[model samples]
Target chain A: MNKTEYLKSLSNELGHMPYGDVKDIIQSIEEHFDEGLGEGRSEEEIAASLGDPKELAAEFKDGVKFNQIMKKRKRLKDYAGPDGRGRIFVILFNAFVGIECWLLLLAAIIAAFCFLAADLAFIGLIVAGLITGTLTEFMVPFIFLILTLACVAVFLVALLILGIKYYAKGLKSYIRWNKNIWNYGLGED
Target chain B: MNSQIKKGILDLCVLALLEKGDSYGYDLAGSLARKVEVADGTVYPILRKLASEGVVSTYLQESQNGPPRKYYHLTDAGRRKLDSERDEWIKFCGEVNEILERGETGGKADE
Candidate 1:
């Protein structure tokens, strides 16, 4: 393909793009051809080395799309800058409503811990009875009680670990949400 | 090399080249095509992308022979990007090489 044919194919492929962009792309490629021709290279040589026009056009489209996305992201970031009114509102809301919710969560976690401690204490008493031969007369029943308590303790420990993990995670995300509201005024991400 | 992989590295390559000196589309493409296995046309889109990202800026300058030539220059952001990307590429290559070397030694030991 000659320079004219190559450019025509590229222009045709870039029909979806704005006219200004298509013209600019063509002009740049045209300059490239002129430079190659100046260096005593044939049109076919330059065109062949430029690869496929359709592929080139596709790359151009991708470049345009990438640019648009970058621009949109920059605008969104600019919009997300700190706002004083939002900050005040977030502070007031957090102080009144959010604190209560946090306190309730803290209370629930503490209650669960207390329940687990009580269970452990009961298990301890059973072991003590077994060691001191106080429950030897009812060995089968004591064994059954120990086994059941052990399972319950294991289950509580697992549950407490999981609950604490989720509690920490929830606290972190809630704090992040407060900060986001302070900064971006409840704007959708 | 995979085309997707090549496409990504090409951005770094263009930045590296522009760091050395300002160049026009043809000259830049020619320099890259000489060393890398890519079509000369591929550099233009990369240049356009870099320009859009504010890493590189273009200006038109008069040529001695014919019409004015469009030149691509590296911005400060482009330099910083190049430094970070070069570091990442080196670190990644080091990791891949270590893995490959370990695999080779392991295969030898099995044999």
Candidate 2:
């Protein structure tokens, strides 16, 4: 089919995704054609080998979302930046950040509650000591204080872990997205 | 030769070709199909994506036979993009070749 007609048909078959995504999917498929053609494949043969355009469009839509396509495009420079290693690191880092942020918030809240509880326990112990004169009151409060302090330390550590995790995971995801079709839902990379 | 592989590489191939010069969609598609097998309809989405990305630009031109035809031209960004991707493609293919050679011939012969 002609280019416009082909796209229109593909759109129809693919359930007509957003115009932007539809366009990106088309571009991605075209690039594949160019590569095969450059290697000396015939047009009719290539077209036939590629199977139905509608089916192909569905495959393309599977892995690659419009957002990821944009991310992939934006990341082209970064992929080429410095060493290839860093790009992977960057993607991993992004994912890590997302994970870390969620965990850190959880840790922080947990720490705060522990801290308050520990302080309350400590006050309660002092009161008990004044009223009853036993070392038991002091011990419970002290233990609570220690536990609260430990939670505080854990919270800080979590922040660091989050930072490192995002870098690694973000990079991994980006690289995987770029090379693998199944990862993005485009098909098999 | 696999439909999956062809579907994956078509867009990159078109963008790479357009980096050389402007051309109508059919001409580009036909040229590409000559090299890699694909449906005529396969090239359109790729063109649309490239155009939308600002990597390539399209303008309507009067056709001798009938309605206006959209001709695609590579932008500077597109050219740079193609250049960078071209580099990556070479490196990736080279690695693939190395793997195949190592696996089948132990570097003693070409496959």
Candidate 3:
């Protein structure tokens, strides 16, 4: 078969594919023929080497069909939205269970800060006692008490910093999880 | 080789060839057909598939003797895929050879 006949047959066989794809395939094949002819090969030789137009068309059709199905599946997946029951369950769980857990965490964090403030206040009271000479009668014991209090305050400060850091991280991840459930349902990464 | 088997490996082969350097459709088809028993037209569909998958990209370059040729270049994704697919192919071949060699020994022992 000559180049024209070969392309004609291939184009006819590719009737099921989109026009753009068919055009592109035909153009590429035509260029293949042109390249062959440029190298002093006959149209018939190139056409023969390319195999049957029907078979080539079948390959192209299969590839195109597979791609179309994949694209359609992706579109369907996007259109599916989050499952209603799953979303409702997530919402209810967040409202009833998750909210209580979050509130408890908030309360714990606040209580921790309160304790840290009280430690600071105690340290201030010790310093005041030292400055006013009220604790001069028990100077040695009072010094030891102030040093112990200072150590406790340092430890509390460190604990509060770490606790706040982890709490913020956990809260951020929890919010992300809720958003994911709301948008993509369960088990969809 | 079975056509089905050949079809599966053809994609990998095309990617491997492109990984070497950018090549036009005709050159790729010629090279593949020389080594494998595929028709010259077979590579086009695979190229289209790879292009659609974003593993390979194509550009038209002016040819000195003929019309502009569409050159296929391997993308980064294509290279990574080649590495993984090559490893899998090697492992698969090893397993197949072992099984075939065992079968051969079994057949010889029976004889």
Candidate 4:
């Protein structure tokens, strides 16, 4: 299957998961395809390497669902102890989490892509600067231009790295957030 | 072996690799699968679990060929887990190896 089809089937299989989780997982998988291309791999090769999405989904469901059951049992005990306010806490918490999940994913997505775009732009500038230097036979000016482009390229690359790091950190927070929703979003004591 | 057991081993292997340095998902998977039999996508789920547990964290690094890669790094918690698990595994395997090798001599003793 192609990237879109693979992601669609995976998400469908993961239909029971928390909404934010499904988005983050699918986004990371999409990023995987992009990375695979970087490694000189075709979509089929990457998909094949990824093995079965259904199995992947099953593992995810197993880990998170297992935790959910345990937390659910704990929450049940707390609610059973004559605490009416606990019910409202559970409802309000899940409602707030449900609404904010996708927005978190969107912010990370935009940050990652912005840095990526900037990185590419600098690479393009370097190439253009080099070509211009070659055609004019201005060796000294060309050297200066290329060196300046290289310095900017390095700086952009660093920024791209930092952006990606922040994006990943944010994604992990979302994963933890999603896991909490499954495992303790029910107002666990 | 059961898949759960295999997955546990895979988890340890991933941790050990990350303990050495950070690695992107596909690269880490490729390294582990080379050393052990595994499905291609298995590492991603393991990664998600680790991330949730605060045992591992991730970042993006651009590769020469494709889009940026999300690299996994071991946290302090992951390192501790790996150390304890590795010790347990070694002891467990040493005992099992001793038991299995005795089969060679046990047959002779019975005769």
Candidate 5:
């Protein structure tokens, strides 16, 4: 394709993006052609080397999306900086991030383990109570109580794992996005 | 070279050029095209990204040829980034070279 056709196609494909970004990409392409012509190269030569404009536009969109994610992610950086505000945002962010979230999960796990162990001990005590003649009347009901507590602990641990599994998936996406940015900036190094 | 690899280093290559002196889009892109297998239009996006990230800043200068052109200069952050990346790149290449050299001699030794 010639220079004009190539750029028009790219601009059309990227029309959904913000205007300035499209303009910048278009201007950059124009400048590329301009320089190529100045250096005694054909527009076809440059265009061929640039590959399909559709592909180029896709890359441009990916780049813009990546940059937007990076900017949105920088809200955390801003909150870390002096003069942070937006208490609601901070609250929402705090629910999902930092040492506190992990600690909360850990607390739930520990609480579940303690309950499970306690239920087992209660079961042992109830068996002992039934085997001997001490507190024989309370044995059956206490056995049921231990069974209920064991079920609750198992349920609690399962819920925590499911919740953490979702959280881990979200964290993985963020890490992947971060890796894209890193590869863009420092991957060659 | 792989285009993916090319995309990763486009910013570093631009920074390497700007570290020498300020350069307009066309000039830098031309030099890069001559040296690297990168697309001519890729440099501007990187320059825009660097400017937004506060790594590099730009100013318009009147060109002798015709119109005013945007010339990019490295910021302090850009300088620090270039330094660290350059150091890491050297070390990375050195390690790769070591393994390559080992393969070259070690294969013979195994025989």
Candidate 6:
């Protein structure tokens, strides 16, 4: 009997899998065929090597069903919140960084304008104090310098921490995602 | 011989026999039993799988003794698979030998 006829009958007997999955299974078998042909083996010789297709199909079907179950489990995990609201914490943390970035930018701009305005105010104060004949006017320049340096330092540190955390979160998600999938596949029947 | 390994290879052995020519279930089982141990029911499942994968085909024929017998024949696809698996076995064995020569596991032949 022809291979096509046998495959058709088998597909009918199995009641057909998802169309995409069926195509994938067929493609894997065909790959074996191509590899055999490349090695100069005849069709008859190669066909006998694979043993039974039913067992392989069973293995494939089991794997697919297992993946679906794992996907559902992941959805549940996202809602259930592992490690005492770790997912919620991550979400809030990300939002905090976004808002922090905008605030920092605004602060820096205000600080810059204030520094300029403070310099102008200090000059004005010194001039007025000079006119009034006071010696305590020199303290204004020192105060403005300290405030600008402190605000700038804080902004730089926040941005740097945000960048590092972004990368860390990305790597963390990748490892956890793969670990969950692996565990699911291994535990499946 | 390791039973697990033998059992795993049983299906391959049966397919190899069929590579020679088409035969019914009884003859195939008998031929395999001579060379290796096999469960009475092992061949049936293997046949079902092979037929399902389009590697083999079956047709019923009336016989003289009691009832109609089912005959199995290998298809082109099945032959191709057998040959490729046979090559893989050869390559895998060669690598195992190399590992053994390097004194790995004291040359224990366990897969």
DockQ of each: 0.61, 0.09, 0.60, 0.37, 0.22, 0.02
How far in Å is the alpha carbon of A15 misplaced in model 3? 0.7
Tens digits of per-residue lDDT, candidate 6, B1-68, equal 77667766676777898888877665665577567765322455466556766788878777555455
**TM-score per candidate, chains pooled:** 0.63, 0.44, 0.63, 0.61, 0.58, 0.35
Docking class of 3: medium
Question: For every candidate structure, what is the RMSD over all alpha carbons to the true structure, in angstroms?
Answer: 21.4, 17.4, 26.2, 18.5, 17.7, 25.5
- The sequence of per-residue lDDT tens digits that candidate 5 reaches over residues B39-87 is 6666766777788788899888876655567788999999999999989
Q: In model 1, how large is the Cα lDDT of residue A172?
A: 93
The ten-residue window of minimal lDDT in model 2 chain A covers A180-189
Quote the lDDT for A77 in model 1: 71
The DockQ of predicted model 3 stands at 0.60
Candidate 1 interface RMSD to the true structure: 0.5
Write model 6 residue lDDT over A11-113, tens digit each, in one string.
5544546677566445434534444455577655545554445654554555456556766776556643234344444456557774475467557656655
Regions more than 4 Å wrong, model 2: A1-12, A16-53, A56-64, A67-189, B107-111
lDDT by residue (tens digit), candidate 5, A94-124? 5677447657766776676677677667767
Model 1's DockQ?
A: 0.61
lDDT of 1 at A170: 83
User: Model 5 compared with the native: what TM-score?
Assistant: 0.58
Off by over 4 Å in 6: A1-189, B101-111
Residue pair clashes in candidate 4: A38-B65, A38-B66
- Cα distance off (Å), candidate 1, residue B71: 0.6
Clashes of 2: 48
Residues A76-132 of candidate 3 have per-residue lDDT tens digits of 578676678668978899889999998998898888788888888988988899899
lDDT of 1 by residue, A1-189 (tens): 999999999999998787899999999999999999999999999999999999999999999998878765865677946778888888899889998998998898898789889988988998899899988898898889889988988988898899889889789988888876776775554
Q: Which candidate has the top score in DockQ?
A: 1
Q: Which is superior by TM-score, 3 or 4?
A: 3
Question: What do the candidate models score in CA lDDT, each in turn?
Answer: 0.91, 0.64, 0.90, 0.76, 0.75, 0.59
